[model samples]
Target: MMRNLMRIEIYDTTLRDGTQAENFNISVDDKLRIAQELDTLGVDFIEGGWPGSNPVTIEFFNRIGEIDLKHSKIVAFGSTRHIKNRPEEDANLQALLAAKTPAIIIFGKSWDIHATDALNISLEENLQIIEDSLAYLRPHVEHLFYDAEHFFDGFKNNEEYALKTVASAIAGGAERIVLCDTNGGTLPHEIPPIIKRVKEFVAGLSETVGLGIHPHNDSDSAVANALMAASSGVEQIQGTMNGFGERCGNANLTSIIPALVFKMGFDCGVKEHISRLYGCSRLVTELANLPHNHYQPYVGKSAFAHKGGIHVSAVKRNPLTYEHIAPELVGNSRRILLSDQAGRANILFKAKEWGIHIRPDDPILPAIIKELKELENLGYQYEAAEASFELIMRKLLGLRRNYFSFQGFRVTDNKYRMDKPPLTEATIRLSVGGVEVHTAAGGDGPVNALDSAIRKALIRFYPILEEMELVDFKVRVLSGEYGTEAKVRVLIESRDGEESWGTVGVSVNIIEASWQALIDSITYKLMKEEKK
Candidate 1:
């Protein structure tokens, strides 16, 4: 028997729900950039924000409409007509139509709580809200999607009434009906029969009017819910890029789409443009100026990173044995995290990445690894802080890189000439590759002055740091210590050319801790560049 392909439609709502996350705000320029990216990612639909919700979103959809989106259909999203206004007369509906996009999505309350509290409408009135709005948009657009907000819990609590609401929208000519897990509490197992009953309850309409699933991740079940719905023959799936939303966030289309196309064997046209997904994911995070989650499933920093000796050894032999998928398949690079847990094979890979070669039987490989472990046991962690790890490798190689190093440094903790002035004066005497050099700098504290002095000295040799800024610097006292005098570790994150790298250091003195991190930061960048 010849096999039939399962083709599913993907609707991306990153610009809308993604912006709803706390502390995230995207500019119109950023919105346009995301639109262009999603377009290139080959999504079936790109839901720009509601046209009448705000001027920024309105202008964004309009501006984006002018740009040609090759394979994606631009969609305008909004709520149903106002309680008192007619759908034809409502300004929001008219604004959605004015957006000039090909499709429109309108959301309405399906739960009794939202109906009574949020919408302040009786059950009958809310059903009309969904029906009338869909009927009004049907004449203007070919694809009109209706979102039954909180549909699952609504169905579970009051099955008859919830299905009645969906029936109303479908009867009013909604091309696709999407059941939303607004609270994201529904389970994967529960979804199969729920979708089956809903499809069966609708009778002959399932084929004429397609089914869709839009889930949130409050219970971290958005992906599972969407996956289960697809198994039940849902034709469309809606979600945001990185699960960014109001509370626990919308489903991460970044994750769901990959699993659907790659694992589930759904012919979503997703693999044809898989390379753009990584860049798109990073672009949205950068536009929001947020730190991308390092463990974010497939695209995260440590997604493909291997650190343990046995695992690293197996991965080198054949990555597919341990890795579910090749990272390059999704435009991501494989990173082997280096820490005390690493073995000789791990060191070999790291050295190879840095353009050095070391045999597995080399005495220094095991000895240096042991030394690194001893340092870590003394509370130095090189996982998040890779710069210090690089320095350890370089020192063990006895390869004196043609670069500068600190010769001497001193700190004076006292009140300055002004009693209110910052209370630290740090003096430093350092050299670049053993060339005698000295400098003293001022800062609010010793750590600040020490870092400033190091960067200032290095500017004379490798001045690229003038533009490369330290985006964030963090420190932690290992939980084992109870006294004030206990040693602490520091993690420094530095960014250059839109790329960032992390490194670590440890010391008893806070200043010493910060200095170790500072030195590692400079060395890692220099060494990383020299290889390139």
Candidate 2:
């Protein structure tokens, strides 16, 4: 007997439903860029925003035609005709046609309460609008899809009425009828049986129509429900990148695509480009200006990271012993995190990565691990400050060269007027190649003044320091018992046009902590330049 294999459709709504998330807003150009990325990733459909909603979405539809998409079809999303207006006179329906997309998807009320309470229309009239709206757009578009909004809830409350609405969609002319878990309350176990009944109902009407699923992540089961629907024979799966959507989120296509391709053996258009999954997920988060979830499956920084001694040793021998899939399959790499829990295996791995030579029985290896543990106990973290850790290793091996020496620094904050801000000034004395230099500068804050003073003192000696810039600075208090006098940790991120590096320091005084991190940052930049 031949095995059953399904060709699943990958429909992405990141530009539409994804924007409904709070603080997740993008401009028209951002949407175009994301759409192009989705097209390049080989998604089957890219649902553009509702053309009737706002001027930005309207401009998107108008301008999107300029880009040539290779693998994806542009889809315009909207709602069914209003009960008060005819199908031809409805503004929402008219805008969908005006968008000129090859595919269109419109949603209608399926739950009885939504029709009676939300729409303020009888259940029978609600069915009429669903049929008439799709019937009107069916002849105009190459592919027409109907979304039975709140479909799972509708089936649970009034199964008969929900089926009536679905029947009306088939009576009209929908190529695909997508059942939606709009409120996202439905669990995974509830999906297959409900879809089975719908399949039977559709079979009774016509055998040509296909089924699709749109699930949200309110219950954190959106991906599970979508997978269940696919196993139960739904032809299309609708979701967004990184699970971004209204309320909690939509189904995460990043996780679902790999599951379908590798675990379930389903064919999808994006299967050939699956290695771009991590980059695609990260690009969406970067464009949104949101922090990436390091714990997110398949694409997060910590997803494939090994920290424990036993785990690292096992993985170094055979990755399948600890990992579910190869991280490279999804454009991600394995990370060996350095911490108090790390052992000799972790040290050797990082040594090789940094091109530092050390044997498995080298005497300096144990010393490095001991110093690392002591620093971590003092609240020093090397995970984000690999430059500091690398410097430590090079110094232990007598391979590091000192570019400059720090003598002393002074910072003062003075406020003269009540309404005006305080004036901060920093003075630094340092020596480069046995030559002494002293400088002073004013800035918006104490750290800024100190940074300015140090740069002023060093730039003339090491002209390359002019290209180095501080990109980000973060501080964390290690203890709260002393409150204002607590020990603090500072992390400084610096970039010099080619790459960025992080350095860290810990001290009881915030300025001292910042100064330590600043020195490490400069040292790392100088070392990188010397290597180049």
Candidate 3:
């Protein structure tokens, strides 16, 4: 496969659809930060949002113009006229023009179902609507593109009508006609011929129009469909950086761009900054406050990870036999996971990562991993959280730290006066490394009581534990089958004095799980402090 010789436009719409995800929200400052990053990533276009639809976006472009993007052209996305007014006079058009960007991409319905039902307009009127919209935009900017949304389904129902829509956009002075799989239901096999037909359709028109694609993932083939379009001669691809959009989302440019350049040997989007791919994916997810999807293809945490014995053995011998590509090519590291099925190689590999040396067949390693796996089966999952996993491994390896000497402590949760609010009472019997033996008490809930008790038990030896604070605590219901007694798991993230660690615990009792995590948090804090 030949790499694309020409510099292809890298358009990113992460800020628009990426934030639409549930539990995902980023402020305008965050969006602009992302836009600035896109500029760093060498994106040619950054589709901000529909200014007419929301005030946040309206305020976004207002300040976005102030930031100097070295390689990015600001683009605003909008839809066709609102059915009643002429496109030229539409308020949406006024909003588009107010953006003051070099390019404007507008979507108009192409699916027969949408044309009649959603728009409540006739088939011919929809085409005319598209024409009016583009005609309205064409003179406003030299770079105008039309998105023929749901083009695949539209083509399937009325091939000529769909092709005619693209033809009409060309006639309306759209420099590019992007055929969109709006519903995201198109399959990989169905894309080639459809894209081919559209390519031939444009070629016949003898217009210097660029062919483009935008696909959704209702069928999990958005990436494949987009690639199929590219293979069939589409020059431009519009997608969100992390496959973000309504419903199942859009093509994942994070995965597609790298796969296109490294695996398929094509050029698009910051081809040389390959190492930033995973970092970019993570940053966007972080900004959105969305937990990174572990199984997301190519750039996800599990993309090059291996666990099963057979797979690990094979991969250790020949990575190409299993891995699609070297992880480092896309700025991701390969990981080997340990579970019941994990082999000695898996444990040894992980140990090596943290600069701990251990033989694969060491007398104690297999036993340690087996015990760890059993603990995991009992409700502890460390695979997704590495810091806590490493802590467990270190403990099993007899690497222990004694930063402070603790006496004894008692914890009580209020079940009377504050029965609903979870009040806690705790007391500690004390000592430190034989220093200022001072003991004061404080607490909020059961976990807090335990934490305060432990801190009081140790402040005499090491005073830094007082500086440690629990930043976040997450509780996971492991199963519902246990009925009222279902096993629960907890992950505690603690930070203090410029250091952080994650601790995990599991038990049938929810409070017990949190208590176990509290113990680990205190222990980890002590160990790290002592080592320092």
Clashing pairs in 3: 414-423, 432-461, 433-461
User: Model 2, 95-187: lDDT tens per residue?
Assistant: 999999999999999999999999999999999999999999999999899999999999999999999999999988998999999999999
RMSD of 3: 3.2
Residues 151-237, candidate 3, lDDT per residue (tens digit)? 889999989788878877887788888888888888999988888888888989955888888888889998888888777778788
> TM-score of every model?
0.92, 0.97, 0.88
For model 2, what is the alpha-carbon lDDT of residue 492? 94
RMSD to the native, candidate 1? 2.7
- State the TM-score for model 2: 0.97
- For model 3, the local distance difference test gives 0.79
Best by TM-score: 2
Note each model's CA RMSD in angstroms.
Answer: 2.7, 1.8, 3.2
Q: For every model in order, what is the number of clashing pairs?
A: 6, 0, 3
